[model samples]
Target: MTDQSDKLFTARLADLVSLCERDGTYEFSSFLDERQCADAEQWCKTNTGSLRYRLWGGYENARRRMLAVYPDYCEEYVEGDYPFVCLTFTYRREDKLTHRDFLGTFMGMQLRREVIGDIVVGEGIAQAFVTEVAAKLITTTVSKIGRVGVKITDSKAFELEDAQKFMDISGTVASLRLDCTVGLAAHLSREKAAVLIRSEKVDVNHHTVSSVSHELKEGDVLSVRGCGRFILSGINGSTKKGRIHINLRKYI
Candidate 1:
């Protein structure tokens, strides 16, 4: 099923590239999940011409991003002009919400995951990016998330902010193995780290990899469920005991 999805995704991207070349105009794709976005980027590098594309999710920094493909002539297009809608969800102050709550509400609508982009949870409010077509459905049907009444509206003047906060930590690992790196960044024992990886609770570059021995390199982003996310910023050098010195930035 995954392979089939990748093939269809690649074909769709190729079609979009062809459309841009043929019409010499801008073409946008439906909101893509993290895996699809990565595939699209790789496809663009080897298959298309100097076709410029922009990845955005109605925010300055987004996790799930969509692609906007255009010719050089369309360089003047702004990020806000992308074919997406930002919906602001407001609930009662007494109802404390979370990212999971907003996402659960959205999923309850039975909308495809591809139709939604990044979801930012704020104090007493949340912002969601969905395909322009899905915006109406969400605003009309999404009234509650587990008893919390939500009022949804189009956020025309919404300002995007950095959705994540980070703290820097430096440590030395015995090796660049996935478990070792995770143990260092998350401050866990080697046994606990291996359990996390083996349980499919870890992701590298947003894709789940269950191999405890998966090699990690610089710039790799690790997302550990319940432990937050981290970026392997650098491998400074080797320690005297043959361990690897590394710098990690943990998202708070």
Candidate 2:
């Protein structure tokens, strides 16, 4: 995220937290991308004290989510409390729609990006998580995504088939430094990974980190420009050679 945009988002998020505290009610934010979600979570953990919050995108492990800030005494969340709905778009298999196609069509509707969450495209259908405000209007008036005719219906679940899949990768690195893991994840030499880091081609948890020495932990997501995205899935014990054993899940 850009510096200016980051500050503005943080400022707005601060307001949401305060509103929940003062009103003793849940306050919801518009959809947040992965980067924004990470930042918002960090902010809450750092500043919110005892107040509780939820970052959910309609389903477990959702890539896009909304910020739901609630009072600490509030125990759990129910479907009725959330402001999002999952919409399914089914079309002919021959239509061959892309993620960009679905998102572009929504943009054509003059909808802001924040109201739309994850748009998971599958073989013959796409399940999109959108705010209740957008879902009502979209399902009623929109009949086609681009030129392909689609049947739109409200769904309680977003199909897992459209969610990201990963290829298991296990390796040992000298250290959990950014360069070490980047090289392992991207299949580049350590030197090449260092170069890539300095050249501004690596992002950890959606934020660019240029330092090759940046320490990484399990569950950190790394995105390389040419290489696919990856997750540091596990950190097992060290090998006989003293290299740290690690498991990576690369997005397929």
Candidate 3:
């Protein structure tokens, strides 16, 4: 997120903070992916002095979230005033659709990706979160997803559980270094993990981290491109032999 290499995006984030400060009112943005959210958080750390901010995704545990920048006086109004709406799509149970289908269809319409949030797909129901401006366009236009007819409704109270699944990965590593933890999370050798880090295949906390010896703290999120995503959930006590015991949640 703080990668000086990506200066353009960082500059845009700076402008958002400045806008919020100058207006002394609530300023929100389109839905942001995990990587973008991380960037926003990093950029705001040193930049936003007195402004308060949050990244809400319209629903709980949302993979995509929107940024809310507001002053202390407007703190109570920010939560209810997020500009995103949730749209529920009801379809035939036999259609056997997927989240990818809904997402691809939305993008095919030329809707900006940042305007879309989480798409919760189910047997006969799917929910998509989007900005209010984008919601008007989708509700008025979208009726089918790739030949499968569907009904779309604005259901603000209707909520669906996100279907992300994960596996438990617990083991002891020589240390909490990025390389050591990546090896355990991805079932790769320590040397191989180091190689992947150097090749820019491992990202810690949504930012590409190439240092093998980078210290990984508890609750750090790691994404190993080909392997998958993982969270360093816990760091238990070390064994008598000095190896560190850790708990990882590997997203399946």
On lDDT, the candidate that comes out on top is 2
Clashes in model 3: which pairs? none
Q: Per-residue lDDT for 1-252 in model 2, tens only?
A: 678988899999999989988998888989998988899999989877778888888777788888888886674653458888889999999899988999998899999999999888888888998888899889989998889999999954666544566799999999999999999999999999999999999999999899999999989999988998999999999988899999999987
* Model 3: ten consecutive residues of lowest lDDT: 155-164
Off by over 4 Å in 3: 1-5
| Top candidate by TM-score | 3
Clashing pairs in 1: none
lDDT over C-alpha atoms for residue 220 of model 3: 92
Q: Write the per-residue lDDT of candidate 3 for residues 22-119, one digit (tens) a residue.
A: 87788887788898888788877878798888999977778799888888899888988998888999989999888889989999989899889999
Please provide, for model 1 over 94-153, each residue's C-alpha lDDT reduced to its tens digit, 9 standing for 90 to 100: 788878887877787788888888887766777888888889888777788778888888
Q: Residue 26 in model 3: shift from native, Å?
A: 1.4
For candidate 1, the 10 contiguous residues with the lowest summed lDDT are 155-164
The positional error of residue 117 in candidate 2, measured at the CA in angstroms, is: 0.7
**lDDT score, candidate 3, position 85:** 85
The TM-score of predicted model 1 comes to: 0.82
Better model by lDDT: candidate 2 vs candidate 3: 2
